[model samples]
Target: MKLQKLTGVWIPLVSIFFGLLAGAIIMLLFGYNPVAGYIALWNGAFEEPYYTGETIRLITPYILSGLAVAFAFRTGLLNIGVEGQVLVGWLASVWIGLAFNLPMIIHLPLAIIAAIIAGGLWGFIPGYLKAKFHVHEVIITIMMNYVALYSVNAIIRNVLTDGSERTEHVAETASLKVEWLTQLMPNSNVHAGIILAVGAALFYWYFIEKTKYGFELKAVGYNSYASEYAGMSVKRNIMVSMAISGGFAGLAGAMEGIGNFGYMTLNNGFTNIGFDGIAIALLGGNTAVGVVMAAGLFGVLKNGALNMPLSAGVPHELVDIITALIIFFVAASYMIILFREKLTNIFNNVKTKLQKGRGK
Candidate 1:
């Protein structure tokens, strides 16, 4: 019985442990020292100050994007357009940052808000279509992503000074910089954005777990017909959920603009963070806390991969293989459950005999 209980608690951890062991085996096959590779990974991610800053930098955008995807998942929506929403948010922030001549305090926040609004509005289009015209969110969001991509590129090319493909650097006062911290960690871009991401996560947790509207959204996600029968307005909940999801994604773009890059340049390809957010959401299990934890784990993995190559001659791509294995094991937890059940039955029989002996 004790063994069975122990297995139940440790199954997931053991799965991850085995996954890492398998990853180490692959490293050995490649003539790399697995220990050295992992050590480097650890040192790169946390042992040094700069690397620790880098981990936080990587985590900043990931947290918001994870929240975006996780929020949609809670309501049973697969918002594939986080990429597009984030792009539009980026464009909006850059545009506002460059076009406005307001004071630093006002201008910076206004730009950030503009990004959020743009992201929300962009998301609203799909939500509205889904609610009214019965259009599928997946298809619409996918198409909209392309629209945001090209449209942003065009705008950047046409409106900026000398037709440059980038916006003017945000005003010094409007920037999200801490000169003291920057001096402490020279060349690092970590800033107040981490606070924003944390705040957003906390707000999301409260909204979903404590609010009536959150209940409506979850009810609608579970069953639209049942939600409507329960007197909840399903369509409204759907629209609200998408809008909120988009806003969170927009905040992600704003963080990139204000905290990381400082100005927007249209990238011709997909922003990989959007896709990464999907993995983060899945790993986090569609909960607010889960998303943050998952993002941290990914942050470690990303930083660690950079270190592995330097220390052990292991390719950074090996980290991807490890991540894949973790996901696979998590998905196949049913086997763990089966093994636990059999062990539990055996333990119960043993316990029953022990009880009989005590009674006699």
Candidate 2:
């Protein structure tokens, strides 16, 4: 069991190391100093207190988005519409925050709940279609992404516009900002959302690892037909799984609306956070701890990329290339395993021959 757990951890770490090595090789080929570039990247992400806080702020939404993808993957579903869910959730939360004048205790939670419900409803459509009509979730979700983008834009234009591309700022009571935290890390956007993100990760770990429903979910994932034979309602599980998955993504949007941005603005394109969550989920092996770690790594990369060109004379696109390489290596993990096994066999044979010669 210990060895298996170690392997799980090591595989992703090894993939990351190889990805960096590939990036370094590319830098060398381009006459860039890989060491200096990495040093600058590290400094940009962690050298200052403000940068550290900024990284954490970025990580907050990433953690939830990653959890959203990971949860669906674990349940044998692919939630490709997390981007749409996030957009709608952002609008829902921001609308509630602006519309209400309640106290902090009530207003804050209400906005969050609205976001979750909006995202859940969005997910439910595809889930229901898949369950009732055997429709492919991927296609429905892709279509929903456009629907969400256009619908939210229309709604913003018609109802929420304040003579600007964004809605009015959320009320102070609905905000997640902690004045002390911001003061502590000057110029950083740290907020209570980080706490919520950590809490959500813990809750997800407990729910998926220690509960009976979690087992049912996993059982269905492993084999839906067998789970149905054993009396589990696969359809119900699918819907619930998607709802929960979407709720996580919605929470990510809530963090942006109520914590980071304090408003929803017109987006000409997807925020890309939800799409990045797919990479996070893959790099994380769809595990809670892995997701958190992967999110942090990605946060650092994104935050530091801005400084790469100025500080190290390396193009910021190098980070994107590195990320793509990491994903490639992760996707080709079976090759890594086969290579390891072959090396292990070679070492064993060599050891056996040396021992026989010594004994003779």
Top-scoring candidate (TM-score): 2
Off by over 4 Å in 1: 1-15, 334-360
Against the true structure, candidate 2 reaches a TM-score of 0.92
RMSD of each: 5.4, 4.9
TM-score of each: 0.88, 0.92
Q: lDDT tens digits, residues 99-191, model 1?
A: 778888798889878888988988888988999888999999999999999988888888765678777787665567777667766677877
Cα lDDT tens digits for candidate 2, 169-276: 899999988888888888888888999898889988998999999889888888999999999999999888888888898889898999889998888999998999
On lDDT, the leading prediction is: 2
Runs with alpha carbons beyond 4 Å of true place in candidate 2: 1-3, 335-360
Please provide the root mean square deviation of candidate 1 (C-alpha atoms, Å).
5.4
